[model samples]
Target: MEAKKDNSGRITDWRSYERVLLPSIKDLHRLDVYEENGGYQALRKVLVSDDWTPAKVTDEVKASGLRGRGGAGFPTGLKWSFMPPVDPEVPRFICCNGDESEPGTFKDRQLLEYNPHSLFEGILLACYAISAGTAFLYIRGEFADWITHIEVELAKLYEKGYAGKNIMGSDFSVEIVIHKGAGAYICGEESSLMNSLEGERAYPRVKPPFPAQKGVWGYPTTINNVETLAAIPTILNKGGDWFASVGAERHPGPVLYGVSGHVNRPGVYEYPTGILITDLIYKVAGGIRNGKKLKAIVPGGSSTPILRADMIEGVRMDAESLKEAGSMMGTAGMLVMDEDTDIVGFLRRITHFYHHESCGQCTPCREGTGWLEDIVSRLERGEGHYRDLDLLTDLCTQMEGRTVCALADAAAWPVRYTVERFRDEFEARCRPSLVPAGISI
Candidate 1:
């Protein structure tokens, strides 16, 4: 099949000949428009037909090999299977983590706004699979527009018997409640989100009893990202093999990449995984803005390590490939930088964000993030010392494994990567000629 580029000149048909998860549907946010485009067909197929049992629904997802879109890339089916056997006496819950707080990550917000029914359908299927009676979607408070979009569709569902009790005239009933977060970055974490939803401070809880074991309100629960669940209805409508046939072999599925920074066209593009970084930047995102040479690219979200332009060569945008490149496929937020970008100054801004967002629950994250911020701020202002580089590296090493969560590690990666890859720039700033007099050698 020939590849077709959309009106915006993006290749609609990428590695996969089809668009499964994110199809080009007009007026998709509305319930009527969604139904016209085969929106709730999957839900009806599973709910009305006796053939699709809850176990079958999970097995199909397992076969499809869908991974979590929220950074970790954990298999979605495997996560659902982790829940303990459902007890009729005790209710299970599903929490949709719609808080897209990661820097440069906004794909979830699109799903929430443009294709909300897909999320609702996916939630219904998940509720059935896990025997969950109650489902809560925790949207970030800042997404006022997205909140309005989803709430409008949700009201339609309740009116049409697609949500609320006795869904689609079946004995299975699921209740979905929308909860807005208090705009805390830490609340993006699943455990912390649960804490926030329950009216507690947004600090991550100890995880010996993982969410599947004990979650919101201290009950059996499962949490999935908006993008992760959004893929479910597609998997159900099409067989699992069809879903797995596209994208990278190991992590086969359509993936959404949010391109920002110095890209010519900064928008969310959905393509099968395993697409080369260079291709996405050049072909998809229209290369470096203003035809400038590429300096670096954050292959995933800000949490992942940065990749020098040279390192990005021949690198496929998938979980394992990005990991092999000493980074991660975090939220797939591909942030590109051009020749004029200042590595030290750029990373200092990132350091400030993490330092400010650290929940202060763990000593290492609480203190280490502040130290990173101070050091990077100094480096950006040309007040850095030669010895400060080593101190910063040591500080990052101390923060990585010692924090209660990955917050400290996220704060450390850009600092470490920018210093390592673009050391000449940082070193130049710390030179005796550049350092101010009386600043101490």
Candidate 2:
């Protein structure tokens, strides 16, 4: 995969591209190969160096300008800094969210399958920063292959004296446990993931005390995304300025963009953020499938607002740029649609996902998602009334920012954006044929 240097376009010269989070290393799956290629060296340096304290680690992360790759784009170092003073007597925890169930997003599965040890190295670094003794790697149940890969790598770490106590003959020790989720989308959320990890129903919790303050069995817990934590060791090895210099300033560091849908090559591309949408689709992703003209794009995952081809001009694939373009760089899952694609049918498919995934903990999300799905289904079947469009928008407005989690808002975003952008298609779907002038049915 090539990298994007600026808004100008994709850089085909792969030799010049900086691969940090997803670095290319030979025999990457093997622990010995990983260590030989400079893996776990950061952990050893931190464990031994007097200058490498938890505060310094957090400061370096902050300096790097690394943001959470898990949709929210929250500052990772700021989140780690929120943890209370690490006490030897008190227990702190780190939960690595691997629940990669978001529609159009599968980058985490790539990292877990191909480069499992990078994740472990990241978990170790995060544990050091947050003063965590135990780290839980929460993976979704559907990802059996990924889970197996992680389990195998974890056993190797244990055997190599990398996971257990007295690691590398140092007092700093940490344990990593892998937990498989029951295929719930809500479990991807930090608070909800903690609940699922505790063997409770996977429902989102209200945020008064955020996860950093009290998470997972009432401890000072910091939950990092799989990609966010996976990039930590790289940030530690290279200076923070180097990491910051790679991507956009606001959201720096390497980003894994999972391009799907009408793209000729639908795979995860590890490129720096701030690449233009046009360059990503055409240059990196091998353009539209079947040589069809571009129609629309879901810049992020299914939950993000849909963007018409015209709206994509000069739009960089970053948080600030997308937000300014009336969308978000959510999960960096770009789903392209060609000219032949059915916009109304696409809306129906996405609405169905949110409807099925609603945990029913919040009234707006529970009822609102179902309502959106029903209206969309009716429209698909040519049974929709003219007022249904207005009704759908109203329901989405009511649901946005009202639920315990962003699931409701996420559910609402694509609906409102699609309706607002492709109103003609939605209107045409509602009424199969226009009534003859002055001729009543």
Candidate 3:
């Protein structure tokens, strides 16, 4: 499908692109329906064929340029390769991070709700690739309805012999388990999710003995995002080159853009990566609600640095482009804002979420998030002083890169970026200091 572009060379007909992750097929959640539509064929191909080995599966995905759909855009196949040569006596595990707890990130929820079998197939493929017999699908506790639906569907897979011992009548046998998280946002972090799976307190573990080296139950494990795993089936069905050629050259493949906030049609839209921010806002999402002018955008999830309207002029929704534009392609969960939005109040609410969700494991995150919430709350109430802006920036430096996990960094980003990017808006809300220039507090 040829996309129509404006004079500016921006793709106007984004709808022309095919949807891979969230296809429009009906009853896709059902096993029979999924099978009818070429689902699980990838897994079968890998398991039954002599040509498609575990190493081959990893190599194909690596060729696809598939990155982690989770916050970090790490290469998916490279991650699977990290699993040490499988030991028959020892157990290796695949943890599917279905904890869709990141604010503004709801695409994974739709995947589980509408087309769960893809994720199941993806998980199985991952298990085969990593030489693991078991895969844990860790979902957040808040997705109760979807969890039940997934469990029901999973039972159907087992009954059909798609899962369990000698799946598809091949020697390769695997078990898929659905794990419901306690709704802790920190659990979305890989190490923390592993801890929760082991029935321990959900806390971020230090790296070095990283999950690939030492994971849940201290076995070699590979933790992948729900969307990341779900994309695997497609990579195998179509050649890896086909998938890689679809999107931004570096970060290729279709991505689920979860657009929310001021857009009129706020929901998940599947399109190739590197779609222009403007085309997504105007063409796909039907523009700003009520014709309000654009103000700012939290291009990725809440943790990604917020961008001014001008900053996104030529920005594309991919890791490299976003990074060059001073933001990260974090979940591609775009939270748009209108001209009338209260910048200070908006940031206050975001700060509150990170503050409440901090696992309290590290002092930087534990104490820093609380302090951030307090300062932002003060600014939102119009009680903040001009020095509070500098203080907020200072607190971010202390919190960022200091915590065990990125929780502290997540909390600090919006505050630091918002304060710096929208300094005038924040300054307008704050009371000016009475002290003379260069006066110390």
Candidate 4:
């Protein structure tokens, strides 16, 4: 597990940040090869060196305007600040949420599978920022390979004096433990993840005892999403001003967008915020396969509302702009739909996903998601009563903010947007020229 340290060596561009992006073809997919590069340098830079104070790091993050890439785009620095500042006697903890389970989002895996060291670097940087000495990486169990991959990296750090007690010849020390979740999407929720880490149900707890003040074995902890932390070393290596300069004014820094569903190029793209949806699809992804015209798009992941292609002008890569557009830049999961995609059918598919993922602890989310999915499925299959549209919208209204967590609210946005904005198309779907036998024509 001893990774050879080489701080001077580097790869170029986005790959420059990734192990796969390493110059040597021979090192491709090899575990030890990653450490040979400047893998743990950031960790060493923070804990090993006394150059930058934790407060200085926090200020830079605030300047960067780096919002969380996981669903809610809450400012990362603000979240860190929310925690009770360092207590000399009390120990603080930080956990990196690596469960990339959100539908249409798979970018965290890229960071794990290719540029794991970058993620590891960010993890250590967060520990230093919060004055924390203990960190946990809650990787999704489905990605067992990543668990193995990062575990090896963690071991490498420990053996090389980058992790464990008395790290980097300093009194300040940090240990990162890689924990595997039992594959529940709810575990992505900070509280739920904390609960799961402690061998409890995945259902979310009501907020008040925010994870910052009381979390993970009852200690002040800072829980950060993977992509949120992965962007750190770059912020450190480059200055805060440099980090802020990369993306849109409000939401700065590069976003690894996972374009999927119906598109010509269905993979990851690392571009800065404010990347136009049209350009992301048309220019970068080469538009839909076989010259299909754009129909609707889910600007973020399935949680965000469905947006028409004409709404492209309003779509911004930042959370503020996306929120203004009646959706969110949630996890930057862009699902491009062609003209052939049925709006009703699309809703049905997403409804199923949400329904399946709902923790069922919140009554509203448990019932509402299922209700929405059932109704949407019926509507897509030409089983609509016109009254059902109003029913569905009402169902969403009940779900929004009525539940313990935003999961219910997340379920509601899409249904509400689809019914209000695209009612005609949905109603038309119910009355096809040749309806199936059981459904009313």
* Strongest candidate by lDDT: 3
Query: Tens digits of per-residue lDDT for model 1 on 1-441?
Result: 555544644333475346555677887889999999988899889888999999999999999999999988999999999999878888899999998899989899877767888899999999999889999999999998788778888999999999988988999899999998868999889999999999999999988799999899999999999999999999888778867866677887888889999989999888888788999999988888788999888877888888888898888998888889888899999899999998888888999999899999999999999999998889889988888888889999989878667788888888887788788888888845466778885
Descending-lDDT candidate ranking: 3, 2, 1, 4
Worst 10 residues of 3 by lDDT: 4-13
Model 2 lDDT per residue over 283-355, tens place: 9899998889999999989988999999999999889999999999889988999999999899999999999
lDDT for 86 in candidate 1 is 71
Which regions of candidate 3 fall more than 4 Å away from where they truly are?
A: 1-13, 435-441
Clashing pairs in 1: none
Residue lDDT tens for model 3, 1-441 = 665445644433356776778889999999999999999999988888899999999999999999999989999999988888877899999999989888999999999988899999999998988899899999999999999999999999999999999999999888998888877899999999998999999898999898888999999999999999999999999879878877687898889999999999999999989999999999999999999999989988999999999999989999999999999999999999999999899899989999899988899888999999999899888889999999999999999999899889889998999999999999999887796879785
Every candidate's lDDT: 0.87, 0.89, 0.91, 0.79
Rate residue 428 of model 3 by lDDT. 93
In candidate 2, which residue pairs get closer than 3 Å at backbone N, Cα or C atoms, i.e. clash? none
Clash totals for all models, in order? 0, 0, 0, 0
TM-scores, each model vs. reference:
0.95, 0.95, 0.96, 0.89
TM-score of 4: 0.89
Question: How well is each residue in 1-441 modelled by candidate 4, as lDDT tens digits?
Answer: 222222432111232232222223444334366556555565667665677788878888888888888878889999988879667899889989988788888988877777777777788788888889889899999999878887776677778776777877877688888889877888888988888888888878788799887898788988888888888877777667766766577787778888997787898888767767777788778789889888888877877888888887846677777778777888888898888977888788878988999999988899889999998988888867677899998999889998777888877888999888789988886643465789864
Local error of candidate 3 at residue 432 (angstroms): 2.3
